[model samples]
Target: MTSSIPSAVTVPSNNVVPSTSTTTEPSTSAEPVAVAVEDSSNLDNDLLDILGIDPTTDKKYGKDLHKDLSVRLQHWTTVGLDKDLKKELKDRYLTPGNCKLIDPPILNAEMKAAISDINVKRDKAIEAKQKVLTSAIVCLGEAITLLLPSKDKDTNLIKLLMDAIRIICECQHSD
Candidate 1:
């Protein structure tokens, strides 16, 4: 006797069988999956600018900037910044000492007084520089205008004119 199997198998439409094998383990590919990461470095730069940090070759100043940034980040975080900002700051700067720094609030009266004193000193220095520059410009302009056309041929007057011209050229070049 010869036996043969059917070419196709069919099941009742209402009695379908589920697949016997199922995947239970997560993927283990070595390639890194892409994720959207929030950039906190730009926030660091903005904080530095807001705190009036100047570019310096001194390592001490760099340390000071880092300390100031850390303190400010802690203070702002405690004072209820936007949720996203707070998260970014915490991710970037939160530390045991940073938490303590904000406890007394950096914006207190003593800090305010110190900042005001620094501002006054800076303004005075700027005023002094401006006065010196203005005097120099006025002196050069007056000397140039006072020279007679006949004196233009004189070597001494020509030297003085050249000196004034040099000052003007230096200022332009500096700008």
Candidate 2:
């Protein structure tokens, strides 16, 4: 006589059963069977999902990802981020001592100050370059005017123009 056994054991949806089991019959032992546990690393998984980054293909963890995450943390409401998620982002992800993407890890108030400082410096640099270029163009225009065979071409002015042209040529070479 054959004792009939169920081919597949019906466990709860939360529980996982391994597919490599060779036994057709259920165990009669009093001890509990080992089951696969769900991955409880929700924070990492949530970050990956939100960033739309595939861990398998993308090995890069650079400033872009850090900046994106930082922006998300700051502007949580823009993405309709849940309160619990916001809490997790602030508490777990936005720590200064955490990921050092930017030197000293600019975040929150520091990030704001750093950005302002950068903008100010960038603007100043652009203004200074513009001034130099304007000066150079003006000098070139004056040199061209001196070259035009005009009646009032002073020897001193012609010498100055030659010097200006030499300086401009040097600047171009340096650049």
Candidate 3:
């Protein structure tokens, strides 16, 4: 008696690959045990199935599907999840007579005001630094202009001034 194992396993239309193996048991009869392959060779189809996305007619299929899924997930998290949580909270904790919604507008406005103040301070600091840089540049330019025309000007002094200006300019004004 000879037994042959299939070289190429053909996956059916349903994307299930079944492999049968004979196992010897304590009882005289041998039984063929069937094992199923969950995923097929077609990786793209498998991935699409895993993501719960259907193939669309759109040219940008991957991008559109990704965007659609993102929107769906976002909506579920923000609205559906929040609604479920609120319902659970109401069911578990608060009664109808004692229930009062927290005023979020007051907290939101305070946060906005604080952020605006910080932004204003940041803008002011930037403007001050810019003014200082402008003043330094003007002073350097005036010193260079004056020294170039003077007959008694020291070369070493001019070189030192240039080096100072270069150092200052190299240190950028931004944070």
Candidate 4:
């Protein structure tokens, strides 16, 4: 029984060749599982599957997966796994959103102001346009003219438009 027991050292199997590996399990304790190195591209699909994200939709696949996964992993306090593998996973998959590398401002007041200003300007323009549309009433493709800055009825673009409108209106009425 003692002779049957293999040592902790990995001995070559019966058909041993120089480059070929035929390592036997460590007989003393639980055999250390030999995990194969997976191709990163394949693992990316697996990670996306785990995250319930569609691969096809993420056109820039690697960057997209890294960004999304890193965000999700922030709240994950505990993960039980091998130390080296955990480090490797963190280093490889959760890279782009690495909080350590780029300290991003969390949507501060300046950003808010810029965004709000654009929205306000857009709204103002839209409101102005709506007023033009509502008040003008398109009277046979004619918008009612507004007064110019100098109140120049003789040489104003608005008066010219109004004149064009009057001519068009007259033609429409005559027809």
Candidate 5:
């Protein structure tokens, strides 16, 4: 997520003094301005940048940020945000009592729909598996009867045997 331009501040520098000086140099326009280099607090500044808030201009930005976060935490307590970092960021950028947080309705609805779809698919899979079990049992019974080498094969009883098989299969197939 690269930004078009980086966030940075152009801090005004003060004239620096030399360490070894027997005689103080007279204040003149000929001397070049010397600024002390200091490390910027990147994390704090970044959080402010993300929230579209500037900390330097506003005196109450830190306090406002804290208050806003506290109110948000009271309302939506399920984000599970990093405690220290969240507070730090909030303190840096949030305006006091700001109520601009986006609601999670969309996410919640999508999750519910996904759960419903999964349940429906699971039910269909179970039904299909039950059908396969019954089909296998019926096929096995038919194969065994057909392979029987008995000479006194009661052809008339075959009808009754088939009806019994059907009943057995129906019972086994019942979910």
Candidate 6:
């Protein structure tokens, strides 16, 4: 009788690849396992630094910065020179009543007074600038009106043209 058995094939040791599978079992060793934990404090600091924010500063400093930025953005938006640009600025900088910093220092009386004085000056300057701009616009409109056709011949057309110009001037000043 002849017995049949398959011979085992052995790969060369250097050519053999380790199995990719893994098995999990309760650890038998008495030693404690070392766990890797992320330091959240460092992460917070990193985020603050990335955003150009200094959380350790006094509250007053942040408030002052916010106030100044608000004024500048408000002026730019009010000028209405570029609608898209103003919209972008408003979205980025004008979060109403939400400009608090992490830990801002309290402002001293002297500092508060200085800021108040500066704001007063800024308001006056803005008013003067607006007056000048309005004067220029009116002067230009008057010059253009002088060049238009006489109202006696083209009364209806002249009225329409004048109305359109007035609307434009009103729109510009209202902004």
* TM-score winner, 1 or 5: 1
- TM-scores for all candidates: the values are 0.25, 0.23, 0.30, 0.16, 0.22, 0.23
Positional deviation of residue 46's Cα in model 4 after best superposition, in angstroms = 95
Per-residue error (Å), model 5, residue 155: 7.8
The positional error of residue 1 in candidate 2, measured at the CA in angstroms, is 99
Q: Which model, 4 or 5, shows the larger lDDT?
A: 5
Clash list (residue pairs), candidate 3: none
lDDT of 2 by residue, 13-125 (tens): 33334532466555554433443343436557677678785567767564554777788766754666576753453444231233122122113565456677777566566
Better of 3 and 5 by lDDT: 3
Q: Name the runs in model 3 displaced over 4 angstroms.
A: 1-116, 172-175
Candidate 4 wrongly placed segments (more than 4 Å) = 1-144, 148-154
Per-residue C-alpha lDDT of model 1 across residues 1-175, encoded as one tens digit per residue: 1112233233332332331224333324442222233343546877767867455633453234477788887886588467685455445433234223222112446655767777756656654444333444444544555665553456687576768757744653343
- Candidate 6 lDDT over 1-175, as tens digits, reads 1112232233333332332224233333443322233344657766867867556664563234477888887876677447575345434432223322211234466765778777756656654444434443444455455657555566565565567557645644553
RMSD of each: 26.0, 23.5, 23.9, 25.8, 29.4, 22.9
Report the lDDT tens digits of candidate 4 across residue range 1-175. 0122232333433323222124443334333332334344667666867868656777753334477777656544355446675455434433123222221113456755778777756656654433333222243122332344345455556655776656644443332
Superior candidate under lDDT, 4 versus 6: 6
**How does residue 15 of candidate 1 score in lDDT?**
36
Per lDDT, the best of the predicted structures is 3
Q: Encode model 3's per-residue lDDT on 1-175: one tens digit a residue.
A: 1124434343332333233435332222243333443454546866867877445643463334477888987887677646566455334432123312210112245555767777766656765444444445545655776899899989998998898767655542332
lDDT of 2 at 111: 48
After superposing candidate 2, which stretches have Cα over 4 Å from the reference?
1-131, 143-147
The backbone clash count of each candidate, in order, is 0, 0, 0, 0, 0, 4
TM-score of 2: 0.23
Candidate 2, pairs of clashing residues: none
Superposed Cα deviation of residue 9, candidate 6 (Å): 50
Worst 10 residues of 1 by lDDT: 1-10
Q: By TM-score, how accurate is candidate 5?
A: 0.22
